[model samples]
Target chain A: MTYCVAMNLAEGLVFVSDSRTNAGVDNIATFRKLHIFGTPGERLVVLQTAGNLATSQSVISLLRQRLDGEEANLHNVDSLFEAARLVGSTLQEVVEHDCGNVQRQGVDLGCSVLLGGQIGEEQPRLFNIYPQGNFIEATRDTPYFQIGESKYGKPILDRALNHATPLEQALRCALISFDSTIRSNLSVGMPLDLLVYHAGSLEVPQGFRVKEGDAYFEGIRAQWCSGLRQLLGELPAPPGDYWS
Target chain B: MTYCVAMNLAEGLVFVSDSRTNAGVDNIATFRKLHIFGTPGERLVVLQTAGNLATSQSVISLLRQRLDGEEANLHNVDSLFEAARLVGSTLQEVVEHDCGNVQRQGVDLGCSVLLGGQIGEEQPRLFNIYPQGNFIEATRDTPYFQIGESKYGKPILDRALNHATPLEQALRCALISFDSTIRSNLSVGMPLDLLVYHAGSLEVPQGFRVKEGDAYFEGIRAQWCSGLRQLLGELPAPPGDYWS
Candidate 1:
């Protein structure tokens, strides 16, 4: 289980991913789901993965192995769309290779990927790559993509996010969304990987790792909890007419 | 699809169910999922259903049919636990009767039920009856149960609800949870049915129907959204050190 979200806003893009993977309740491990690729001053691509650990790791490993090769890879892709296609195809390849044996044992080998980045003069773009090698790009009306354990955290994004939102504000919403998910689900745990990119900036964005006890994260969690309680208290109860 | 939730708290029980029922996106209708049973002043039982509309309706119809018969029924049940067992077994019977034909057409015949109320001298109790004809009672540690499209509304309840939560506060939380679910899911919608039971009050509890233009509902929706935005802005964003 995993929870990864990325937002494409007017100013830039923001990405957040949890680091927990579990075979079951008893067998759990932490793995970085966010991977950074592309040249420092040319193309910057970020990939966040969820689903079968083996399939995602294989897809990432294949992408990395091909980065220095002559093949069309994240580094050499002409645009964000092409990078998304490359990632989707890699995901499909890994799933196809392992699904037969895995499914025989009643295990799922499917993986979902989020590919977001900027290329040269193009604006930052975000794509949700399905397990079947197909993808959809984020647009002005729908500015965010979430995969894996998405519903628990989706109401906030649906209510607050839009293309006009500032990059910093979008980042805050992403963290709050993650907070809701982590509190409701045990499978999605910390530390978290966060990345923010300025639109049209062709530099590899700096990625931040937020671990347990991070002051900002803890503060947001506590404040949000108390704020919600207070807000609920302030809301008027049902009218007395309804209490008959 | 449907969304129904019930909470067992110290003050009493709270049940909230959305009225939307859909066979597909284009085939949607409004049908009450919350049902009240029991003899007034003796026992008060509320049943909330989710899943295949045909199956849930059949279960309810069967229970109603047997109310005046020699067979054990909700009105005749000695305890809330017995009422839950009756609901669970009725659900299983309906599914078993229809599953073969339904599955042949690739349709589901399963339904999940939430049974909560007071009977005789027992305290208010809540039960989540699965499609398999088995049920689990809510305890002090876990005081709520949600069925169908539940995840979108679950984070708030997970954070704010406990056995000791005041009945009015619990009712507020339940409404907010439904609001979140309705915003994020098209399958769950307006005209919610809300019922609150006070412990030791054997009389039938009044049920509130909250429609689209209800003033209090609209106010809560507006206030919760803006309050969340204000809280997000007040929380300090990630430290400058992480933004490199």
Candidate 2:
């Protein structure tokens, strides 16, 4: 299980991904799901994946292999959409190669990716690529995309995010969303990879590896919990009418 | 799609369910999902259903018909476990009768029930009954059960609920959970039915119908959105050491 989220906001983009992967409860392992591709001051593309770790890793390696070729890469993609297209095409190639054989063994070839970043002069953008290689771009009304264990973290995003949200605030909300998920699900754990891009910057944006006990994340988690309890205590309750 | 949650807390039991049912987004209707069976001073049993509306309705009707008969109804069951068995048996009966036929047409015979209440001298209890007729009782560690579209509403409960939680506060948490679901998914919606039971009080537990515009609900919803925004503003920014 994994929980990865990426948001496209007015100030820029925010991406967060959990690191825990498991075949079952007893076989958990850490696998960083965020992959960064770019040249400083040129272009930055962040890919966050969730689902089968093997499939996601393969997609990443394939993309890197493509980068090593004498052709288009994250550094040279003509547009953000084309970068997303390259991702979709790579995912499709992997699926076609393994899905049928995996299914015969009762295994699923499942993986989804969140591709978000800036390319040259294009605005920062985000796309959620499905297992089938189909994808959807984020729009102003829905400025974020999430994959894997998404629901637990979704309410906060639904209520707090918008196209006009500042990049810093979006990063805060994204972290909070991940905090909510890790607390509620044992399968999703620490050592988060987060990236924030400044729109049109075309460079490696500020990023972090949020491990457990990281002071800032710990503070946000504690404050968010306390704030929720305080909010709950302060909400007006149904009159004694309902309980009497 | 539906959202029904029931919790067994120190003060008593709390059950809340949304009323929306739809064949598709274009065709939606309201139907109560909370069913109560009791003899005013002797017992109070609340059943909340989610999943296939037809299956749930059939199970409810079967239970009602059993009550109409003089011997095997919930009213005659000596223990809460027995009552749960009765509900599970009814669910099994419905599944056996229609599940195969339904599957032939591409639909599943999906349904789940959250059964909670007191019977005779037994204390209040809650059980989550699956479609296959198996059930699991809520424990101190797992003090609540939610059925159907549960994810969106889960974070609040995972954070705030515990066995020691008071009935009123637990009920508030449950409502906020439902509010999150309703805001995120059209399949889950309004006119929620809520039942809160006091420990050792077998008959006629406190209850209410929380509809759109219901004063207290409206207040809480308004306050939650406001509180979330305020919290977002209050959270500290990314540390300057890492964020530019």
Candidate 3:
């Protein structure tokens, strides 16, 4: 299981993901689900992966290997959207070549990818690429995309995320969302990867590998829990007559 | 789709279910998913149903019809745990009698039920009965059992709920969880049914059909959304050096 989220905010894009994978309860393992690709000051593309670790690794590997090709790569894609399309195709190719035997053994062939970044002068954008070759771009009203174990962490994003949300604040909310999920589910764990991008920077963003006992992450998690309990306590209860 | 949640707390039990049921997006309908069975102060059983409407309704109908039989009916169940087993068996009977024809037509014939309340001298308990006639009881560590669309509303309960939580506070949190699910999902909607049980009081605990424009429900809905926003605002950002 995996949980990966990407926000396309006014300030820029933010990406975060958990790094735990398992074929079964007894065979759990840690694997990186976030990948970064770019040329400094030119373009920065972040790809967050979920499902079928082998497929995800293959897709990212294919993209990295393409950097040396004369063909379009993350560095040379005409636009961030184009880069997203390339990712979708790359995943499709991997599935076609690798999933046949795996699926015959009753394994899932599906994978979900969230692609976010800036391409030259184009505004920062994000796309959720499906297991198939199709994808959907995030717009202003819904300027975020999440893949895998998404439901547990989605309510916070749906409620608090907006186009105008500051990058740091959006990152904070993502951490809160992650905290909620990690506490509720064992499949998603610590050592989270978070990348903060400032729109138009077109360079590697400030990245954090949040491990267990990371002071700031721990503080936010503790404060958010207590603060929520306080807020719930403050809310007015339904009147007696209302129920009667 | 549906969202129904039940909590087994030290104070008592809480059950809430959205009324909206649909065959598809175009054909939406309302149906009661919460059912009550009790002999006043002796035994009170609350059953919250989810999944196929026809199957769920049939299970409830069978249980109601069995009240006149000589066999162990809900009113005569030895304990709340026995009542849960009864519900599971009744569901299996419904599936046995009704599922074959439905399955031949490619329709699913399963439902999930959350059964919670007290019986005689036994303490209040909660069980999540699966369609296969197996059930799992809620424990101190996990005091709540949710059926249908459980994930969206789960984080809040995961963060704030404990076995020792007061009934009213738990009620407040369930409402918040329902509010989150309702906002994010089109299938789960207004006109929710909520039942609040007081451990020893039994009988038909306070029941509320929270309709659209119900002042109290509306108030909580509004207050919770804004309160969450404020809480998020107060959480401190990751330290500058933390990310570096």
Candidate 4:
């Protein structure tokens, strides 16, 4: 299990992902799910993955593996859409290669990715790529995509995120969403990888690698807890014989 | 799908349930999930059901029919635990009678209940009854149980609830939990039935019916949204280039 989220806002794109993976409670380990690809000013795309670790990592490696000589790649993709296509193609290839063996062992090749960033003159964009290698781009009406352990955290995003939100504000929303996921699920843990890309900046974006004890995340956790209690305290109790 | 939560708190107990029932998105209807028995000072036992509506309704009907007999029934149970046993026994009876027919169509029997209340000198108690008729009492550590569409609302309870929490405060927590569930899931909707019981108080517990226009709920919803944003605003942003 994992929790990864990416948002495309007016100011930029925001990506947040947790770094915990477990086969069983005793087999827990840290694995960064966010993969970054860039050529500085030319392009900057990030892929946040969830589902079967082997499949996701295989897809990522296939996406980055050199294809002989000069050929289309995330590094040289002309548009964000093309970059998404490259990811989709890679996912399909990886699934085709691995699904047969996985099926023999009674495992399903389940994997998905949140792909987002900018390339050349194209506007910042985001997409959710499914296991079948098909994808859906984020639209103005729905400006974010989340993969894995999504339900626990979805309410915060449903209420808070929009296409016009500022970069920092979107970051805040993503963290709250992550906070919700972490509390309800053991599969999503600390050492978060977050990226905030300013639209059109093109160059490598600013972000954080948030480990446990990271001051900012600790503050967010404590404040959210306190704020929820405070807000709940302010709500009016039911009137006379309300439950009678 | 449904969302029903019951809490065993220091003050007593609280149970809230959404009434919407859906076989699919196109097939949805209103059906009350809370069942109340007895009057003030006699004994008050409330049952909140979630999961397969037919199975739950069957259990309810069975319990009701038992009440029509001259001997034992929910109203005549000597204690809250005995009332829970009656509910569980009734559920098993319904399953025995209907499960074979239901499973023939490839649908498994599924239903659960949050049974809570006071009877005579026995302190107020709450139990989460499973589909198999087995159940577990809420403890001081956890103190609450939610069934169906639970993940979206679980974090609120994880962060806000405890056995030491006052009944009013716990009620607010339950509402916040319900609010989150309603926001994320179409299957869980209003109007909500909220019941609160005071510890050792052998009186008819208070009940609050929250319709769409319910002012307190509206205020809580708005305040929670704003409070979450405010809390997020207060957290420090992650450091630049930490992900590089």
| lDDT score, candidate 2 | 0.87
Q: Second chain only: TM-score per model?
A: 0.97, 0.95, 0.95, 0.95
Highest-scoring model, DockQ = 1
The numbered model that scores best in lDDT is 1
Query: Model 4 over residues B1-244: C-alpha lDDT tens digits?
Result: 8999998888888888999999889999999999888667868888999888888999888788788687678888797778777888888888888877778888868789999888887777888898888888888887889988999999889988889999878888888888989988898999999888877777775577899978878887888888777766776765555434
Model 4 chain B: which ten-residue window has the lowest total lDDT? B235-244
Model 1 ranges with Cα > 4 A deviation: none
Give per-model TM-scores.
0.98, 0.96, 0.96, 0.94
Per-model DockQ? 0.72, 0.63, 0.63, 0.61
CAPRI class of candidate 3: medium
Deviation in angstroms for B63 in model 4? 0.8
lDDT tens per residue, model 4, A141-191: 999998988999998898878899887778878888988899888888998
Output the lDDT of residue A227, model 4.
81
In model 1, what is the error at residue A159, expressed in angstroms?
A: 1.5
Error of 1 at B31 (Å): 0.9
- Model 4 CA deviation exceeding 4 Å by range: A67-71, A241-243, B70-72, B241-244
Instruction: Name the lDDT value of residue B212 in candidate 3.
Output: 88
- In the predicted model 2, the residue pairs found to clash are none
**TM-score-better candidate, 2 vs 4:** 2
> Which residue pairs in candidate 3 collide?
none
